[model samples]
Target: MLFNSSGFLFLYLPFVLAGYALLARVRPRWATGWLALVSLFFYGYWNVRYLPLLMASILFNYWVAGRMLAAVAARRRRWLVFALAANLALLGYYKYANFFIGSVNALTGAHLQAWEVLLPIGISFFTFTQIAFLVDCYRGLAGEYRLVHYTLFVSYFPHLIAGPVLHHKEMMPQFERPPGLNAADMAVGLSIFVVGLAKKVLLADPLSTLAGPVFAVDAHPQLVEAWIGALAYAFQLYFDFSGYSDMAIGLSRLFGVKLPLNFNSPYQAANIAEFWRRWHMTLSRFLRDYLYVPLGGNRHGRYRNLMLTMLLGGLWHGAGWSFVVWGGLHGVYLVMHHGWGALAGQGPPRCWGRMLTFFAVLAAWVVFRAPDLSTAGDILHAMVGGNGVALPHGLEAYASYFPVGCSFEGIRWIDFSGVAMPALLLAMVLAFAAPNTQQIFRHYAPCIEQLLGTPSCLLWSWCPHSYWGLAFSMLFLACVFSMNRVSEFLYFQF
Candidate 1:
């Protein structure tokens, strides 16, 4: 169920929260069990058929971790390897089986019909979360194991659908604490949720309107149309993903649990490396800790490790060649950034660095957002003025702005239909000028503050005051009104 949907926002959340609160007071163990049951219900709301698969995964992983913990040093490695392979095998079959078959068919000209394997939602996230837990078991990082706490950790609804990718150490301990409702946490959490709701409903959804037509056009887009589409998508993805992250953190906060921060104004980063450090940070951490470190990381030299890690990271997003190219583009950018640093013995100026990084990211997103490589190439070609510029018929009066006598064969200057210039402008201002949800809520300690560090005292601080409460109420109402055209969160497809 979408967090923004009426059933989830009004019905499911209210019922679960009230039940948990009442149960925790009298029977704490029952409350924990209640949470696990409700979380499973939440998952099953998407597909009843997959509910058993999810439960089986949790049970299997819990048993594997227990065995790994009990085994001696000599046998533990074998157990860990086996557990990792099992997790990967499950993920591969569900997520990539058809992708692999299609690729093989194309290469060998075989008539191998692909199987209709349904990928369980969040399979990538849960599998990786379990794999990390198994590794921690081998490394002696994880402590005592309990079935109830382990079940809650893996199945918690907020981060389960899409995640900041929880670690066993970060979450299992929280399940042991007595659950209760905190007024302060509720206020802050609700405000953050409203902000995220505004972003998704108010910003991201509208931006999709502008982006959709451009990407879907059968004919080549004009130069202006191509840019509008690209920029619209860039902002669309930023707000969509960031909004989901905020809502996840806020929902966890409602349960008195703090999820790790996932986004940190990545668009403002001055370099590709810095951008990765800020964007989907938990995934970056996962890759670094589990994948990169085991592959020798920078110990084998910087360039080779960086490229390999990014290539694998890209493939992790989806089973598409476009995603691989998208990842490879970032890898190449990082390599150049490092090489330039080595040659110049200094960093690029801040303003210039940020501009370059933003544009590079913007360009790379074309590949990420495209359905296929051909579509990606068409958009890129138009972006470079291959289709020439032409104003829409009604706005042909402005043709004087272009170079003298530079008329195209058929097209006008640029077609601006379906483009919401005002909304696009507003999105840009918010992205570049405004503080993100994290920065706004930095002082709340709503989640785990230590990992995010202390907020800068100099920036504006917004505590949970009456005025802020009123402001958030209005925002919440606005979001409610927009719910008539409710849409699914973009990350759900992945």
Candidate 2:
């Protein structure tokens, strides 16, 4: 279920939270079972029939890995490989089969028709998590497995949908015990969730409104329009994906589990390497440890390893050539950044490097966002100085980016005279410059404590501002919750 949806906010989350907290006090083990069952219901909320498939996957891997860990025979290692391959085989059949079949059909001019296949929800996430579990089992690192803990690890609803990709080691301990809810953690979690909700509902959705029309139009416009469209999309995508990550982190915290932070203001990076370090950090780390290292990483000649790692990393996103191109572009950026740094014996000027890298990354995002390679090429062709059409008449015709009839101003009678331009300008500035709500509030704690003249002992020992912040945070969250049609988290597809 979508975190932004009213059904999820009003119905599912409330019901689950109430049940969980109630059960936690009386029966902790039962609480975990309730969670696992509820999590299944949550996944089935999208498609009830798929619940069996997901459950079977969890059961299969759980049994196989348990056996692998318990077995001592030499052939047990080979059986573990078979089990891992079978799990991957299921994933490939569902996710990549059509992508491969279509490519093959086009290449050979054969009469092959693509099969209709529905990708299971959370398959990409759960599959990877289990694969890690299996590998840990093979290495004899996985401990005694409990069915409840395994189920919770695989199906915890917070990161289940789109993940920070939790490792088996990271989540098992939390499942093994329940901690009393800390008021301070709840306050911080609620605050983060509300801020993320605002980012998705208010900022990302409105930016998408600005982006959609320009991107949808087939014929190119002036260079100015092209740049505007691409820039709007870049901003929309970042806020949307990162906004979801924030909500996920917050929700995980509600259960007394700390999820790894996924983003760190990636736009502030001075180079492509720095950008990767900040953006989608968990995924980047996964690629570095699992795929890159397996392919020799930097231990082999630098350029070759970089290219191979990136190409595989690109393919890991999806079974598409465009994804490959996107990864390859970043690989090229990394290689260039490293070589330049080595030759100069120092990093480039921070500001200039950041600007250049930001634009280059932005340009690559066009390829990543496009529906297909041809569409990507069309957008890029327009972007790099394609002056395709002349405006119809006077400057008034194309004065606004929106079409004549469906413009936001045309549809709504909201006063444009007072706060519209100022709000837009403020939002744009805040998007680029202002510290995130998390950072700002962290700094505000000290000032708030001092302003209240609270005892130094009490103030330092506990979060003095939590109660006040919690109330305001809940109100803001309610506001976001009320806006039900906000778009799904952007990373859900990946």
Candidate 3:
């Protein structure tokens, strides 16, 4: 279930939180078990059939890890290898079977029929999590697995779908600790969730309104529309994915788990190399540890390492040529940036390099977002002065699908475009100029220290932290209003 939905926000969350908190003081073990059961229910709430798949995978991995750990025979390494392969085989069959078949059919002109396999939600995430666990077990890095902890690790609903990819070490301890409700921490969690909600529903969805029409043009429209769409999409994706990440982080925090931060305002990067370091950082980390480092990393030839790393990284996103090309393009950009930096003997300062890097990355996102090579070419052609026609008259038809107004005549003079402009500009400034809102608030560490230190504030149970109280109330109201129009999270398909 979506984190921002009404059923989740009002019904599921409140009921679950109350149930969990109520059980925590009296029965901590039962509380965790209940959480796992609730999480399973949450998963089943989406599609009941998929629930068995999730449980089977979890149970399979748990058994495999235990078997691999208990093995004493020298030849039994093969069993561990077999188990790892089986886990990967499950992932490969379910996620990549059709993709592989389609590729084979396309390349060889063999009339191979692609199998219709329905991808289970969060399969990619759970697959990776389990694979990592099995690898750790074989390596003797993890201790004996417990059923309760293993179940909780796999089924925790907060980061279940799109993830920061929790490691066993990160999650196990939290399950060991009591899952009590801390009012101070709970308030912080709710605030972050609301902010994330606003980022997705309010800002990201409206930006899509502008972005959708421009991209719908088969040929590019005016340079104005082209830039608007490209820039708008760049921001739209930032807020959308980052919004989901924020919600994931926030939700995890409520349960007293600290997920790794996903986005660091990647648009602020001074170079493509830096951009990758900032964007979808967990995925980058996964590639570095699991893929890039294993593929000889930069320890070998610098250029080869960069290319291979990016190529595999691209392939990891999907089994498509476009994704491969997108990865290759970034790979090339990084190589060029590195070569240039070496020649100059230093990197550019944050401001100048960041703007150039933002534009370079923005240009590349056009390729990433385009449907295929031809569409990407068309977009690039338009960007470089391909004389395309004006946008069609009914371009604003879908604008009314959102809460935003369509035309100036039926609505107030302020159009949807006008309404979103201020938010758009604010997002741009935040993307470029400031540290993220979190880092900015973190600057107030000393004031927070003094307030808690004060004699008068301690006695009252109802006293709220001023900044959090103000910010989250505004965010909560905004998210409530924003969700009145439904918008899909950008990463849902992936």
Candidate 4:
């Protein structure tokens, strides 16, 4: 069930929260068990067929981790390798088998029929979380394991769908703590969730109206249209993914658990490295710890390891060459940033760096968002004015604003509705100027990073006051009103 759906918002969450609250007072273990069952039900609500697959995965990993913890040093290393390989093998078969088959078929002229495999929801996330646990067990970093706690760690609904991927050391202890409802946490979480709901319903969904048609065009879009579409998508994806992350964190907070921050105003990042540091941060951490460090990281050399890490990281997003190219572009951007820093002894000026980084990220997003390589190339070509530029029909009165001798003929603006352009601009302004959800809720320590820093005066802040409560209530009601056409979160596909 989608987090945005009424069934989830009204029925599922309320029932689970009520039950857990009641159980927490009498039996905390039963409360934890109740949460685990509820989480499993949540996952199964997406597809009953995959429920067994998820259960098997959890059981397998738990057993493997137990073995890894008890083994001798050399045996532990072997067990860790075995467990990692088993997880990767499952992920690979479900996520990559068809892509690999298609590639081989194209190259070798073999008619290898790809198997019809259904990827279980959140396979990548749960698999990686388990892998991290096994590695930690091998290294003696993880504490004692309990089947119930481990299951809860893997199946917790908030981070289960799309994650700020949990680490065992960070999450398991929370499951062991006494569970109870906190009015303060509930208020703050609801406020943060309302903010996220507004982002998705009011901002991200509307922006898709501007982006969808442009990207869907069979022919190349006009220069202005291409840019509008590209920028619209850039903002659409930003708010969509960031909005989901906010909701996830907020939901976890309602359970009195703190999830790591996944997004941090990445559009404002001054460099590609900084962008990576902010965007999908847990994924970056996973790549750095599990993949890059194991592959020798920067210790051996910066360039090769960085490129390989990003290349695999890109493929991890989806089974598409476009994603590979997107990852490669970011990899190139990072390498160039490193080279420039080495020669100049410092990075570019903040303003210049921010602009450059945003543009580079925007360009890579074209590939990421496109259906295929050809469409990406066409959009990129149009973005460079390969197709002529023109103002829309209503803007003809501004012809005098153009350079002398310049003709407006043949250049055409996209025939957007009255609200599209304004909405797009508004979304952009908010993206660049507004404080993120974490920033607004900084006082509550809604995310891990907030634990160390003082709250800043910015666009807005959540406070335990009547005005803030009324504002959030209005936002939540607005989101509820817009829920007629329920849409899945964009990250759900990944």
Off by over 4 Å in 2: 73-76, 388-428, 437-478, 481-484
Superior by lDDT: candidate 2 or candidate 4 = 4
Instruction: Identify the leading candidate in terms of lDDT.
Output: 4
For candidate 4, the C-alpha RMSD (Å) to the true structure equals 4.6
Give the per-residue Cα lDDT of candidate 1 at 97.
Answer: 94
* Stretches of candidate 4 exceeding 4 Å from the true structure: 396-415, 443-464
lDDT of 3 by residue, 1-494 (tens): 78878889899988888888889988877888877888899888888999999999888888878787888757347766887788778878877898889889989999898888887778777777777777677778888756988898888888778776778887887788877876455545665676678888877887876677666637454554567677778899899888888888777777777777788888878788889889988777776777677678777777777888888667666667767888898889889998998899778887889888888888878877776767776766766656342333455665655434223223211124465666777778767776774674454322334335554332111233445444556667778876876766877656
Clashes of each: 6, 0, 0, 0
Per-residue CA lDDT of model 2 for 349-376, tens digit only, reads: 9998888888998888877777677767
Model 1 is weakest, by summed lDDT over 10 consecutive residues, at: 457-466
Tell me the TM-score of model 1.
0.93
Clashing residue pairs, backbone N/CA/C < 3 A, model 1: 389-413, 390-412, 390-413, 390-414, 391-413, 391-414
**Every model's Cα RMSD, please?**
4.8, 5.6, 6.3, 4.6
lDDT of model 1 at residue 235?
A: 92
lDDT of each: 0.82, 0.73, 0.74, 0.83
State the displacement of the C-alpha of residue 340, model 4, in Å, after optimal TM-score superposition: 1.1
